[model samples]
Target: MHEQDFEVDYLIMGAGACGMAFADSLVTNSKSTLAIVDRQHRPGGHWNSAYPFVRLHQPSAFYGVNSRALGSTLATRQG
Candidate 1:
C-alpha cells in the first residue's frame, strides 16, 4: 500500500456515516485538518443503498458526532 502523508489534525479513512459524523463534529468544534475517504462514491454509508423515505432506526441526533447536530430539523419537527 502507498503510504500517503497524513499529517492532519484528523484523518478519517471512511467517509461513511460514522466517518463523516466525526469529521463534521471535529470541523465544527476546532480548527483541524480533516480528511475523509470511502471506497463508496458517496457519504451516508449503506443508508444510500436503502430505499428512499427509509429512516435510521436510531435518531440522527444520537448517530452523528457530538459537536455537530445531524437531523436537527427532523428532531425538532418530530418533537
Candidate 2:
C-alpha cells in the first residue's frame, strides 16, 4: 500500500454527528484546513448501523449541524 502525507490544522477522528458539527463550526468561523477520518464507509456513525426501527432519543431538531436545520421549516409550519 502507498502512504501519503496531509497538512491540516484540524484532524477530526470521526465523521459522526459531533465530528461533522465541529468541522462545520470550524469552517464557518475560521479558514483552517481540516481532515476527517472514519472507519465506516459513510458518515452518521452509529446512526448508520442502527436498526431501521430504532429512533433518535431526542427530537430531530435537536440534532444535526448548527448552521443548518434538521427538518423542513414548511413541514413544521404546516403541522
Candidate 3:
C-alpha cells in the first residue's frame, strides 16, 4: 500500500505489547498522531496466537499497556 493511503505522524510497524507501549507513551507525551499495523488479525501479537491451555508465566499486571495493568494483581493467583 502507498504511504499516503495511511498518513500519520508516526507509523508503528507492529501492534505487539512493545509497540503498543511505545505508542501509548508517545501519545501521552505529545499530540502527534500514529498508525500501527500488524500482520495478525488482532493486536497482542504472540499472546493472541498462544495455545488456549497456555497462561502467562509472569503476571498479567506486567504484560500490558503501560497506562493500565492487565490482570487483577501479580501477587495473587486465581484458579
Predicted model with the maximum TM-score: 2
Off by over 4 Å in 1: 1-7, 50-79
Judged by whole-model lDDT over C-alpha atoms, candidate 2 comes out at 0.79
| Worst window of 10 by summed lDDT in candidate 3 | 70-79
In candidate 2, what are the lDDT values of residues 1-79, reduced to their tens digit? 9999989999999998899999999998899999999999977777878854555667767775656667555123322
Pairs that collide in candidate 2 are none
lDDT of 3 by residue, 40-70 (tens): 8877778767754676677676775655557
Worst 10 residues of 2 by lDDT: 70-79
What local lDDT score does residue 77 receive in model 2, on the 0 to 100 scale?
33
Q: For model 3, state the Cα shift of residue 11 in Å.
A: 0.3
lDDT of 1: 0.72
Arranged by lDDT, best first: 2, 3, 1
Which candidate would rank higher by TM-score, 2 or 3?
2
Q: What would the TM-scores of all predictions be?
A: 0.57, 0.71, 0.66
lDDT of 1 by residue, 19-57 (tens): 886787788888898778788787777787774466567
